[model samples]
Target chain A: MSTGVKHFIAFAALAIILIALPKVFVSGSAHTMMSLMGIMIIFALSYNILLGQTGLLSFGHAVYYGLAGFCVAHAMNYIAREKIGVPLPFIPLIGAFAGLFFGALFGLISTRRAGTVFSMISLGIGELVASSALILRSFFGGEEGIPTNRTKFPPFFGYKFGPQIEVYYLIAFWCFVCIALMYALTRTPFGRMCNAVRDNPERAEFVGYSTQRVRFIAFVFSAIFAGVAGALATINFELMNSQSLGAGQSGLVLLMTYVGGVGHFIGPIIGGVIITFLQISLSDITKAWMLYFGLMFILVVMFSPGGVAGWLALHQPLLKGGRIFRLIPAYALALVPMAMLAAGLIMTIELAHRMLVDAQSDGSVMKLAGWTVDAAKAQPWMLAIGLLVCGALGLKLAWPKVREAFAAQSAEVAQ
Target chain B: MTPALSLQDVRKNFGPTEIIRGLTLDVMPRERHAIIGPNGAGKSTTFHLISGRIKPSSGSIRLNGAEITGMAPYEINRRGLSRSFQVTNIFPRLSVFENVRCGVLWSLGYRYSFWRFVDKLRDANEKAHAIVEEIGLGARRHAPAGILTYAEQRALEIGVTIAGGADVVMLDEPTAGMSKAETEQAVALIRKISEGRTLVMVEHDMSVVFGLADRISVLVYGQIIASDTPQAIRQNKAVREAYLGEEAH
Candidate 1:
């Protein structure tokens, strides 16, 4: 197939998946989750524009997202009170413009120096806005935050967006458009220059390109997209607050981008969906969900610095040469030990937490996995230690087979 | 005829230590000039000052009779003067072809264009491919520049320097780490690319300097000891005592 046709097919597949998502899940909560995922995907990609493509490390990207959200929320309220004729779907454009305004404003100062200085400046700006949001009651509404009704806007084609499903479709539309534009930007001469600037600013200057200008442009675009994500979020939750612009929000997007892999275009999207899913599902079942997230991030940083996308990309040569089947048995053999290790570790942590922290209310007994185990007894501790030791031994014995199989398959592919 | 580059009493001081002290030289248009010196004699420092990577503590530097003193490197480059580094400074993550294409971008009037796809720019692509072939890295054009052999990286550096179509091209130690055959190939490549363009080079290799330079300047202790034709430079007493010595023979 030609490149054009292939791209068309891929786009069609993506559209189908996005449009069919809410229908397949078919619940109010599912619609809410999908909408959140769409917003996060856009946010992560915008963050990637700086971190991955441009090699900038920003600690306060949520400033744009939250600022844009607040701006759109104010616009929505003003439109409703004065009966402004602007429709609801076009509100993100307001956010985009606001984002661009602040982006250019902040970028002018921060982009003068890159690397550590740039990161520190962004952190300072983020904190400035976040703290100011508390005192600026008229705009930020203090602790209560500003809330607006999306349905107050004039109807678009007789649709007031009264349902969550309609809002999901709106976010999905913006998400796809922003993703397509960001991807197209990467193919342009400007995008190539951004890469050149990122890799070596000194050489980039000798090549007759201003490194600061390239970074400023990328920073602005990244902020604009992040603002769009914030706009969609404002419409979904019907509120904009200080938490939206906080450090925790910035950290969440960074976690998604790095864990997904910063090297590839699709990495942020994968990260956005996975992190959002885990955040929603895991938070319901366990109070230690954040601990799991931190562990996952550390593992990704240590073993797979490229993140999940990088790990998936590593298998491409094997798949191309049809040598993937040769390593299947080794992978399957390794899976059991890995599962055992994870279970043993989780069990130990939960049991220890129960014993030390919850000791007063629960007596010495802990209810876990439909079994009542006495924390004072030695049997459970011995069982946990036994599981941990056996899992480690199994992993030690099985790891070499996986490595040898992988090396042999790689050699075969190389030949 | 106007000189391609002119530096007059150009002195650069880092803190209190003067690196280029009152160094004055003139490079004629379309001539290959070489600056040769011992280690720590500030040959690379001179290149940095001329290229606008660093400013002179005091003095005037001009290109094509236009004052470019204290200008940014990109502004100097926009005025049609380009230089390669002594250390290999090509973008390591970019492919060899991409590295050359980056050099041609500003010259082709594609400054900061975010709308048009680069692959669709036929002229840029053609020029970049021609440069890759000229540098003898056509087969390895798709490989990342970081993984290229040392000689190949040096060749890519020269290719990048000349790709911008600058009127004045400066190279720092183009054959610093090459073997005899590799140095011969590099000299040929440099000579071919510098045709109709004024070339300035800092070289440690005597053979390369003697074979390629039209005129030679001997720099020692941050000052030019002698500036003359290659044969005259080979016979100058001060040049012999300061730099050439037995190597000139």
Candidate 2:
């Protein structure tokens, strides 16, 4: 299929999945989860606008996302208190405008020097705002944060979204619209010039497009989308605070997007969903979840530099025909060790945490496999050995088949 | 006859160091002109002045009687002038076809095209294909420009300059590193390519200069010592002493 057609089909599939999610799951937790995915999708894709399309790395993108969330919350409170009166849905637009204003303000200065300088300026801005989130309590609501309600809107679909499912549709709709606009922007003439500027600024200048102008336009557009995400998040959660605009949030967005893939529009989408899932699931299972997350990010950066989109693109042909079934054995062999190692590591971490934090009497602690051991005397060597043995066996069994699959895929595409 | 391009009392200096000192030359329309000099002789600098890559320190540059000394490169390009660089400046990541298409698009009055899709523009595509074929790169039209051989890259550069359809075309060392057959092919390409236009070049190869340029200018230490028809240049004592003296052996 043509590239455009393929992209359209992929977009359609995504929309269908998002629309049917609440019904298929029929759970409040699933709705909240989907809403979180919607918010991250915006953040990651906006970040991709600078990093992937313009060849710029920004370290303070969370400032816009976080600030926009704060702006939306303020707007929501104003509406609720009759300081301003309108539907809650229109408030995200206010968030987008806030994002655009700040993005342009920062972009004007930051885009003056592209590579490392831009990254540094963004980092500085992120730190500055995160620290000030406490000072601006009147507007930012201090540490407690300000709360607003989606129920403020007149009931449109016979539901006020007091439930998370109603909010999921709203967030999902906005996410789809923003992603589509961002995608369309990439295909525009200005978008092509963004690529040109990314590749060679001098050449783009000679061709009569100012490099700064292109970069500035892209920067502002990215910020607006990020802000929209912040606004959507506020409506879903019914509160906003400094943490919404914090540097950590910015770093998380970057990690998710890069892990998903930058250049591909769909990459950010996949990344947002997966990272959100892991953030919630992993944290519950272990205190060292963040450490594992960092290691996983680094591994992805090193091994699959192109991220998940690139990895999936590489596997596209193999997944198309009778050869699809051939992947099962490889997948199974890969999954066995991966599952074992993950479970073992989580078990080890949780058991350690329980022993230390909730110590048992008689100086003995309960273990994962129904055994009790002296908490102070428990050795980590056995857990390490088990994880390593399983991991090594998994790698050994997976490599040859994985290599064969890649080689076959390469050969098939070359023709 | 009126000159197509003229540089009168052109002197380019950076801070205190003088580069092109009081240089004056004239090329009539349709003349194949060559400037030859040793390194730091300001031959490339003179091209930079004419192409508007750099403004002249003193004096004026005129193309068909209108002064155009300090105009921007694109403005100079728009006003019936175009040039290739000493180093190949083609966009490496783009396909050979896309590179030429960009050249054709700007020349065909479609620059900064936001509304027109590059692939859907038939006229630009056809013209780009024609130029690619002209430059002997039709077979590799889809290949990235960076992956092409050095000789092919130079040929592609020439194609880009001419693709603009400018009145005066300047090529800097068009066949600098090509083999014997490739240089011969380059000379033929230059001759065929510069048919109706006023062609200006800076060449080190005496053989190529003798075979191609109708008028030759010899420069020594940033000053043109001889400007004459090829026959006169070949016989001038100062020209021979300044340039051909070392090559006589």
Candidate 3:
């Protein structure tokens, strides 16, 4: 099939999936989860316009997301208090304009240089704004932040958006639009120039482009989309707090974009969904989830620098030739030991947390992956250590054979 | 006719060190000019100066008698002068067609536009394809530029430099690091592209310089010691003593 047809079909399938998700899941939490996915996807994709598209490494992207959230929150409040005619669905545009204003305001100085200097400026701006969010009590709402009611707006098509489903659809609609536009951007002359400037700014200039201007426009666009995301987020939670624009928020988007992979268009989407899911659900599963997230980020950077998308893209040749199945045995062999190692590590961490952190309150007894373990007991500790050693040995033994299988398939593909 | 490029007493100084000292040069339209000099004679620096990669410490540089001293590189490029680097500078991850298309975009009035799809720009795409074929990289059009052979990349570089339809093209060591066979092919490409266009080059290879340059200038210690025809440069007493004497040995 032609790529255009393929893309259309893929996009249609995604739309269908978005429409079907809430219906199939049939839960308020599921709706909330889906809404978060839409917001995170927009935020991550916007971040990629810098990290992936333009080769900008920004540490302060969350500033746009957060500031835009505040803009939306305040706009919602004014509309509600003044009894204005605006509806809730269009609120994200306020965020978009705020993002654009801030993007233009900040992009001027930051885009003057690329590399370490640009990154430092972003970091500085992030700190500056994040601090301002606290000190500027009137607009930022001080420590409590700004909160607004979505139901306060006039009904659109008789949909007051009091229901989670309605909110999901709104976020999903904006999500689809932002995602499509961002992807379409990659096909434009400006997008090509962004790539050009990213790859070699000097060459870009000689080809009749102001590389600084290209980066500045990209930064503005990125921020606009980020603002849209923040607006959607405000709609989601009915509030915009300092944490919304915090370093943690910015760091989360970076984590999502990187782990999802920064090389491909869909990388950020995958990152947003997966990381959002983990961020929401993993806490319920383990208190040590942040540590796990950190571990995963480190591994992704070191081994799969292209993120999950890169790993998937790397295996396309094998998948096309149906050689993937041949390597499955090698992979399966590694998976067993890898799981054991993961389990052992989890048990050890949980045990340590119980003994060190919660022993005074929750006691030394805990349930881990269906096993009752006492942190005070030596048998469990010995078992955890044994599993660790055995898993390590098994993985070490299995690694070369897996490499051999990969090499063999790669060679065949090359031939 | 006014010279296509005129650098009158151009001088560049880095901190306290003066480079491109009192460099006055002029190239009439459509003339093939080569600047040859020993190492550290500021050959590349001169290219950088005229191309707006760096500003000269003092002097006036004009293209087609229009003063362009200290103008931004993009502005200078828009005024119909384009250049290539001594190093292989290109958008490495982009496809070869995309690389040439980037060169063609601004000149074709598609500057900084995010609205229009590149594939939909018939003028840009066709021009890019034609240039790719002209450079004999038709088969490699879809290949990422980073993966091309060095000779192929140099060919692509020259293609990009001239793709903007610039009437004046400056090349810095375009044939640097090429094997004999590759250099011959590059010379052929250079010759074809420089036809009816002003060509300025900085080259270390004597054979390539002697073969391609209509006129040669010897730059030593940031100053041109001789500016004349190639044969005269080959025989000049002072030129030999100051520069080529060491090479002749």
Q: Tens-digit lDDT track for model 2 on A30-103?
A: 77887899999988999998988888899889889888888888777777777454665677898899999999
Candidate 3 reference-contact recovery:
0.92
True contacts kept of each: 0.88, 0.19, 0.92
* Each prediction's number of clashing residue pairs: 0, 2, 0
lDDT of 1: 0.93
Weakest 10 consecutive residues, lDDT, candidate 2 chain A? A360-369
lDDT of 3 by residue, A19-75 (tens): 888989898988998899999999999999999999999999999999999988988
**How would you encode candidate 2's per-residue C-alpha lDDT over B1-249 as one tens digit per residue?**
778899999999999999999999999899999999878899999998988778998998999788998987777777788788788887776678767765666667765545556666678778889989998999999998889999989998888778768889898988897899999999999999899999999998999998999999998888999888889988999877777887885
Write model 1 residue lDDT over B1-249, tens digit each, in one string. Answer: 879999999999999999899999999999999999899999999999999899999999999999999999999999999999999999998899999999999999999999999988999999999999999999999999999999999999998998899999999999998999999999999999989999999999988999999999989999998898999998898888877775645
Quote the lDDT for B74 in model 1.
98
**lDDT, candidate 1, A1-415, per-residue tens:** 8876887897888889999998799989999999999999999999999999889999999999999999999999999999999888999898898889889999999999999999999999989999999988899999988899999988999889989999999999999899889998998899999889888999999999989999999999999999999999899999999999999899899999999999989999999999999999989876678888999999999989998999889998999999999989999999888888888877787788778777888687977678899878889888888888888999999999999999999998999
Docking class of 2: acceptable
| Pick by DockQ: 1 or 3, better one | 1
Considering only the true interface residues, what is the Cα RMSD of candidate 3 after superposition?
A: 0.7
Better of 1 and 3 by lDDT: 3
Tens-place lDDT per residue, model 3, B1-249, is: 999999999999999999889998988899999999899999999999999999988989999999999999999999999999988898999999999999999999999888888888999999999999999999999999999998999988998899899999999998899999889989999999999999999999999999999999999999889999999999999899988898878
- Pairs that collide in candidate 1 are none
Looking at candidate 1 chain B, the ten consecutive residues that score lowest on lDDT are: B240-249
Superposition TM-score, candidate 3 onto the true structure: 0.98
Candidate No. with top TM-score: 3
lDDT over C-alpha atoms for residue A78 of model 1: 91
